[model samples]
Target: MKAVVMRNQTLVVEQLTAPQPAHGQVLVKTLACGICGSDLHMYHHCENVLSGFRNANIPVAFDPRQGLVMGHEYCAEILDHGPDCDKKLKVGTRVCALPFVISPTRFEHIGFSTPYPGGYGEQMVLAEPMLVAVPGDLPAPIAALTEPLTVAVHAVNRAQLSGEEVPLVIGCGPIGLAVIAALKARGVGPVIAADFSPARRALAEKFGADQVVDPAVNSPYASWLQVAAPSDYDMRSPLALLGLGRQPRPCVVFECVGVPGMIQQMIQHAPPRSRLIVVGMCMQSDQIEPLMALPKELNVHFTFGYTAEEFVHTLHALADGSLDAAAMITGTVGLDGVADAFTQLARPEQHAKVMIVHD
Candidate 1:
C-alpha cells in the first residue's frame, strides 16, 4: 500500500506492506483522515519524543524513527474481519474507531504504532471493540472529526459545565472549537473564545461563541471581563478586577492552546473558584506559578482524549447538524499534501480541520 511514511524527520509517500488485522481486529479501508496535533508532535519528536515513552517504565514500543504511518483522527470503511472478530460489524460499513491497543504488550494509539499501522495508509487494522459505526448521512471528511471532537467533548465533561459557569476557551484551534461545539450541544452558552488569529476567531463566533477575544487587544482577560458578568466573588485586586463587562463571568477556562506559558496566562487571569481545563497537547516542559492559582483557589484539570460514548456522541452531533461540524473543516488535501498540511497547521490562522482525502 502507498502511504505517507515518516523517515528521518520528514514524511514521504512510499509503498509499505498493508496491515493485516490480527485476531479480534477488523481491516478498514482508509476513507478520510484528519491531521491531528499529535501527528505533528510525532513528526517532530521522531527520535527524541518523551511523552509516548513516559507512559510506562517499559522501552518505547512505537519508534517513529522506524518509518511510521501517522494518523488517528479517521473515518474508514470496513473491508474484512480477522479471525474471531466481532459478529456485529459487516463489510462495507462506514466507521470510526478508537486506537485501543497497538499490541497486547503495547499502548493503542493508532497513528503512533508502526505494527498496527495508521489511517495515513490505504488500509489499517482496528480492534473490533474500538469500531463505532458512522451514520449513513455524515460525509466522510466530517466524519473524520469524531476523534478530535470527542477530545473536546471529554474536556467539557471534565469542566462539569453548567449554565452557571461561563465558558472561556483559550485558543480557537480545532479542540477549542470542539469545546465550543460541545458547549452548544449541551445548551451551555454565552461562551467567550480567545485567539490571536482573526480567521480563527471568526470561525469560533460561527460555532456559537457569544463573543470573541483577540489576545493582542488590551489583554484578552480584560476584554473577556469587559464582555462578561461578574461572579459572586468580590475581586478587589486591581489586576483581577475592572468591572468592565456586564456578561456572565468566565468561570470555566478551557486551555486549548498548548504552547508555552498559556496555562500560566489562564491561571493568572482566571476568576476565583474557577476551573481551568487544560486540553492542549503541550509536548515540551513549561512552568506555572502556584501563587497565581493559589489566591483564586482555581481548580486545574488536565484533559486528554475521549470516551467511547462521547466519540459516538460527537458523530451524532455532526450528523444531526447540532454541532455544525462540517463548518469546522476549512480545507482538504490528498496524501501528498500531508507534509505541507503539517506546516500550515502550525500557524492555524487559515485552517481548522484539514482532511487528508485518500486517493
Candidate 2:
C-alpha cells in the first residue's frame, strides 16, 4: 500500500505493508482523514514533542522516530473483520472508528503509547466496538470530522452547558468552532467564540456563534461581557466586565486554546460557580497556577477524546447538517503533500482544518 511515511521528520510517499486485523480488530479502507493539531506537534517536534510520548498511555514499544503512519480523525469502510469480530459489521459499510484503542482491561490494547497505525494509508486496522456506523447521508469527507467533532462535543458535555447555561468557547480552531456548532444543535443558550484568527472568527460566525471575538484585536472577555446581562456579567470584578450586548452570562467556559497560561486567565475571567473545560493540547512545559482553584472556587474539567455515544452524536450532527464539517476543511492534500500540510498546520492561525484525501 502507498502511504505518506514519516521517518526522522522526513515525509515521503512510500509503499508499506498494509495493516491486517488482529484477533478483535477490523480492517478498514481509508476513505478520508483530517489532520489534527496534535499530528503537527509530532511532525514538527513543536518545542515540546517528547511530552506526547509520555502522555500516550500504551506500553512503550514502538519508536515514533523510526516513522509512524500518523493520522486519526478519519472515516473508513470496513473491508474485513478479524476472527473474533462481531457479525454486526459488514464489508463496504461506512464507519467512524475511535482512533484511540486503549482499555486498561484489554491485554493487547493499542494505547496512545505508540501511534495507533492510524488511517493515513490505503487501509488500516481498528479495534472492534470502537468503530461506529456513519449514516449514509454523511459523506466520507464530512464523516471524517467525527473524531474532532466528538472532541468538541465531549468538552461541552463536560463543561455542563445545557439549555439553561450559555457557553463561552475560548478559541476558534476547528475544535472550538465545532463546540459552537454542537452547542447550537443541542439548543444550548447563546454562545460567544474567541480567537485571534480572522478567518476562524468568520468560520465561527458561519457555525452559529452569536458573536466572535478576536482576542488580539478585541478583548474577548471585555467585548463578550458588555453584551452579557448583569447575571452573565457576574464575574464580580469590574475589570472583567467588557462585552456590550445584552446576552446571558457564561456559566461554562471552554478553554480550547491549550496555551500555557490561558487556563488560568479563563478561571480568573470566568464568573464564580463556573466550570472550565480543557480541550486543547498545549506544550508540556507551560506553567500553570494550581492554587487559583481554591481561591476562586473553580471547577476544572479535563476531557480527552470521545466516548462511543458521543462519536455517534457527532456522526448524526454531520449527517443532518447540524455541524458543517465540510466548511471546516480549509485545505486538502494528497499522500505526497503531507509534509507541506504539516508546515501549514504548524501555523494554525493561518489555516482551519486540513484534510488528507487518499488517492
Candidate 3:
C-alpha cells in the first residue's frame, strides 16, 4: 500500500504493508480522501503543540504513532470484514466514515481524546462504529466531503436556531462554506458569510451566502456596523466610528475562523441573545474582556465530532444531492503530494478542499 506519513515533523510518501481489519473492524480501500485544516496544521508544526494538550489541546483524533494515515475526510469501499465485523456492507458498497473511533468506556475516560487512524492512504482498517454506508452513485470526491459537512451540520445543530430566523457565519473558508450549505439544508434562510478573501467570498456565494463581506476592501468593521445598527453613533466609540448602528444581530452566528480577535468582535456586534458556535481551530489562547461575554448571557458551544447518527445523516445528505460536496473539493493529489497539499492548506487563500487520490 502507498501512504503519506508524518515522521519527526516531516511528511513523506512511501510504500507500506496493507493493514488487516481487527475484530469488529473492516478493511477499506481508500477511494478519495479530503485534506483537512488540521492536516495542514500538523504538517506545519502546529500539531505538536495543539495535539498534545491534555486539557486544551485539539488532539488529532487519529495519531501517526499508531501507523497513522493523514487524511480524515474520506469515503471508501469495504474490501474485507473481520471476524466480529457485521456483514451489512458488501465488498462493493461505498461508504462515508468517521476518521476517529471511540468506545463508550474510552469516551468517559477521555472526553475528546482518542487515537484512531485517518484516511490518507490506499487502504485503511475502519472500526464498524465509525463507518457510514455511502450511495453508489455519488462520486468519490463528493462522498469524501461528508466528514467536514457533518462538522457544519453539528455546528448548526449546536446553535439551536429556529426555522423562523436566518444565521450569520464569520469566515468564508471551507468550514464556513460548509455551514452555509448545512444551514440551507435545515431550512435556514439567507445566511450571511464574512471573510477577508475575495476567492473565499466567491466560494461562499457559490455555496449559499446571501451576503459576503470582504474586510480588506469594504472594511468588515464598517460593513458589519452598517447592517447591524440603527441608533446613536456618538462617533466616539470604535464601533460608532465604523458607522455600525445598534446591533440587529442574527439569531445564530457560527464562528468558523477561530481567530482570537473575531470572537471579541462577534461579542461586540452580537444581538441581545444570539447563540454562537465556535467551529474553527484558532490555535491560540484568546484574550478578551470578561464583561463583554458576561453581559449578553450568550450561549457559546463547541462540538468535537458528529455523532454516529449525524454521520449517517451527513452521508444521506450527500447521497441525495441536498449538499454538493464536489464544489467544496478544490484540488486532488497523489500520495507524494501530501506534503505540498498540507503546505497549501496552511495558506488562507489557497484551495478549498484538497484530496489525496488513492485510485
Candidate 4:
C-alpha cells in the first residue's frame, strides 16, 4: 500500500506494507480524508507538540524521527474484520469512526501515533466499536466531515446555552465554520461570525451566520452588541447595583482562532458575564491577563474533541441533511498531491477544507 508520511518534517510518499487489523479492529480502505489544521501544526511543529505532550504527562505514541502517517477526519469502506470481531456491518459497508483505537495495553490516536496508520494511507485499522456506518446516499467527501463537525457539536454542548444567549464565533476557519453550522442546526440564532478573510466570511454566511464581519473593517463585538443588549444592571456604573443601568444580554463567544493573543483579546473585549469557549488548538505558549476578566466575571472554557455520543449525533446529522456541511469541502487531492494541498491550505482565501480522495 502507498502512504504519505511525515519524514524529517517533510511529507514523503512511500510504498509500505499494509497493516492487518488487530483484536476488536476492522480494516477499512480510505475513501476521503480531510486535512485538519492540527495536521498542519504537527507537520511544522512536531518537536513542540511532542514536548508539550510530555510536559503534560500525556503519553504520545508517535516519534517524529521515525516518521508517522497523519490524517484523521476520514470516510472509509469496510474491507475485513480481525479475530474476535462481531462484524455487525458487512464487508462493503462505508463508515466513519472516531480517529483512535483502544489497544489492550494502551489507547492510540489513529493519525498521530505509530502502529496504527492514518487515512493518509490507502488502508488503516479502526476500532470496531467506534465505527459508525455512513447512512443514506451521502457522498464519501461529506461523510468524512463527521469527525471535524463533532468538534463543533461538542463545543456547543459544553456551552450549555440557555436558549437566550447570542453566539459570537470569532473566526471563519473550518472549525469556526463548523461551529456556525452546529449552532444553526440547534436553532441558535443571530449568529455573528468574524474573520479578516472575505472568502471565509462568505463561507460563514453560507453556513448560517446571521451576520459576518471583517475585523479589519468592523468590530464583531459591536455587531454582537447590536443584537444582544444587556437588560439591566450596568457593570460600568456603581449605581448599577440598584439595577439602574442596562446590562449586556447573555452572550457566548467561541474563540475559534488558535493563534496567541486571541484569548487575551476576548477577555479584554467580551461583554460582562459572557461565556467564552476556546475551541481552537493553540500550539504555542499564550499569555492571558486573569485580572482583565476578573471584574467582568467571565467564564472561560477550553474544549477539545467530542464525546462518543456527540460524534454519533454529528454523523447522523450529516446523514439526515440536518447538518449541511457539503459547502466546507472546497478542494480534493490524491495521495501524491498531499504536500501541495498542505501548501494551498495555508491561504485561507484559497480553501476552506481540502480532502485527500483515494480511488
Candidate 5:
C-alpha cells in the first residue's frame, strides 16, 4: 500500500506493507480523512510531543525518528474482519471508529502508535468494539469529522451547563466552531465566539454563534457581560454580593486556543464564577499564576477526548442534520496533495478542515 509517511519531519509517499486485522479487529478502506491540528504539531514538534508522552508514562509503539503514518479523523468502508469478530456490520459497510486499538497489553493510539497504520494510508485496522456505523447517506468527507466533533461534544458534556450560563468560546478554530455547533444543537442560548482571525469569526457565525468578536478590536467577555450580566451587578461593590440586585448569569468559557498565556488571559478577563474548559493541546511548557484564579473562584476544567456514548451521539447528530457542520469542510485533496494541504492549512483565513479523499 502507498502511504504518506512522516519521515524526519517531512512527508513522503512510500510503499509499505498493508496492515492486517488482528483478533477482534476489522480492516477498513480509507474513504476520507481530515488533517488534524495534532498532526501538524507532530510534524513540527515531534520531539516535544514524544517527550510529553514519555513523561506522562504513555507508551507509544513506534519511533518517530523512523516513520509514522498519521491520521485519525476518518470515514472508512469495512473490508474484512479478523478472528473472533462477530461481523455484525457486514462487508462494505461504511463506518467510523475511535482512533485506538485496544490490545491485550495496552491501548495503542491508531495514528500515533506503531504496527497499526492510520487512515492516511489506503487501509488500516481498527478494533471492532470501537467501530461505529456512519448512519444515513452522510458523505464520507462530512462523516470523517466524527472524531474532531466528538471532542467538542465531550467538552460541552464536561461543562454541565445549566442551560442559562452564556457560552463564550475563546477561539474559533475547528474545535471552537464545533463547540459552538454542539451548544446550538443542544439549544443552549446565544453563543458568543472570539478569535483574532476574521475568517474564523465568520465561520463561528456560520456555526450558530449569536455574536462574534475580533479580539483585536473588542473584548469577547464584554459582549458576554452585555447579554448575561445584570445592569446593577457589580463585583467590586460589597453590597452587590447580598443578592440585592439581579445577579449575572454565569459564563462558561471554552479555551480552545492551546498557545501559552491564554489560560492566564482567560483568568484575568473572564467573569467571576466562570467555568473555564481548556480544550486545546498546548505542546510546549506553559506558565500560569494560580493566585489570579483564586479571587474569581473560577472552576477550571481541562478536557480531553470523548466518551463512547458522546462519540455515537455526535455521529447521529451530524447524520440527522441536527449538527450542521458542512461549512467546516473548506477544502479536499488526494493523498499526493496532503503535503501541500498542510502548508495551506497554516493560513487560517484560507481554510478550515481540509479533507484527504482516497480513490
Candidate 6:
C-alpha cells in the first residue's frame, strides 16, 4: 500500500505493507480522504497527541519512531471481507465510516492505528461494525467528508440550538464552514462569521453565512458591536470600533478558530450569560484568565467526536442531498502530495477540505 506517513516529525510518502483484516473486519481500498486539522496537530505535536491517547486509555502507545499513517475523513470501497465479517457490504460497495476500528482486544482510531492503517494509504483495514455504506452515486470526495460533517453536526447538537438564536462563528475553515452549513440546514441562520482569508469569507457565505467579517482587516468583534452593544466602546475596544450600539449581542458564539487567544477573545467580548462553544482544536497549553469569563457567567462548552447515531445521520444527510458538501472541497491531491497539502492548509486559509485520492 502506498501511504503518506509521519517520519521524524515530517510527512513522507512511502510504500508500506497493506494491512489484512482479521475476523469481523474487511479490507478496503481508499477512494478519497480529507486531510484533517487534527492530522496536522499529530504531525507537529506528536508528543501531545500521544499524551491524549494515553489519557484516553489507548492500550497501544503511538510509536512515532515506527511511523504512522493519518487520515480519518474518507470514502472507501470494500475489497475483501474477513471471516465472519458481515456481508451486508459486498465487494465494490461504496462506503464511509466513523474512523474507528474495533479489534478483539481494544478499540482504536483508524488513522492513528499503525496495525489497521488509515485512508491516507492506498489500502486500509476497517472494522465492519463501524462501516456506513453510501449510495454508489455519492461522489467519493463528498462522501469522504462524512467524518468531519458529523463532527460539525455533533457541534451543532452540543449547542442545542434553536432557530431563533443569533449565532456568531469564528473562523471559516472546513469545520467552520460545516457549522455554518449545518446551521442553515437546520434553519438556524442568517449567521455571522469571521476569518482572516478573503477566499474563506466568500466560501463562508456560499455555505450560508448571512454576514462575514475579515478579522485581519479589523478585529471581527468590530462587526459584532452593532448587534451586541455592551456599553460605550470608547472607540478602542473591538466591540466599540465598528460603530456599535444597536441592540444587545447574540446569545451564543462558536469559537472555531484554533489559536492561542481565540478562547480569551471570545470570552472577553461575549455577552453576559451567553453560551460559548469551543469547537476548535488548540494543540498547545495557554494562559487564559478564568476571571474574564467568570464575571459574565458564560457557559463554556467543550466537545469531541460524534456518537454513532450522529455519524449515520451525517451519512444519510449527505446521501439524501440534504447536506450539499459540493462547496466544501477546495482542492484534490494524491498520496505523494499530501504532505504539501498539509503545509498549504497551515497557511491562513489557503484552502478548505483538500481530498487525497488514493488512485
lDDT of 2 by residue, 244-325 (tens): 3443455678888777888879776666556788888775656667665666567888888777888887788788777665
TM-score, candidate 1, is: 0.92
* CA lDDT, every model vs. true structure: 0.82, 0.75, 0.72, 0.90, 0.89, 0.82
Off by over 4 Å in 5: 59-61, 236-245
Model 4 lDDT per residue over 1-359, tens place: 99999999789999999999988899999999999999999998889988988898776657778779988999999999999999999899999999877656887889998888899999999999999999988899999999999999999999998788789999999999999999999898789999999999999999999999999998888778877875443445655323346666688999998999999999988877789999999999999999878877889999999899999888989999999999999999999999999999999999999999999
lDDT of 5 by residue, 1-359 (tens): 88899998899988999998889999999999999999998889888888998897877657987799999999999999999999998999999999987766888998897788887899999999999999989999999999999999999999998898899999998999999999999999789999999899899999999999998898888888888887766755554334446678878999998999989888888866789999988999888887878866789999998899999989998999999898998999988999999998889998889999999
Q: What TM-score would candidate 4 get against the native?
A: 0.96
lDDT for residue 91 in candidate 5, whole number 0-100: 94
Top lDDT model: 4
Residue 194's C-alpha lDDT in candidate 6? 91
- Flag the better candidate by TM-score, 2 or 5: 5
TM-scores, in order shown? Answer: 0.92, 0.87, 0.86, 0.96, 0.97, 0.91
Ranking by lDDT: 4, 5, 6, 1, 2, 3
Q: Give me the runs in candidate 2 sitting further than 4 Å from their true place.
A: 46-61, 102-116, 231-250, 290-293
Write out the backbone clash pairs for model 1. Answer: 101-108, 102-108, 226-245, 228-247, 229-247, 229-248
lDDT of 4 at 14: 96
lDDT assessment of candidate 5: 0.89
The order by descending TM-score is: 5, 4, 1, 6, 2, 3
Candidate 6's residue-wise lDDT over 255-356, tens digit each?
887778888888787666678889998877656779877766678898778999999988888889888878988899988888788889888557888999
Give the Cα-based TM-score of candidate 2 against the true structure: 0.87
Residue pairs of candidate 6 with colliding backbone atoms: 228-249
Give model 1's clash tally. Answer: 6
Candidate 6: lDDT of 301? Answer: 92
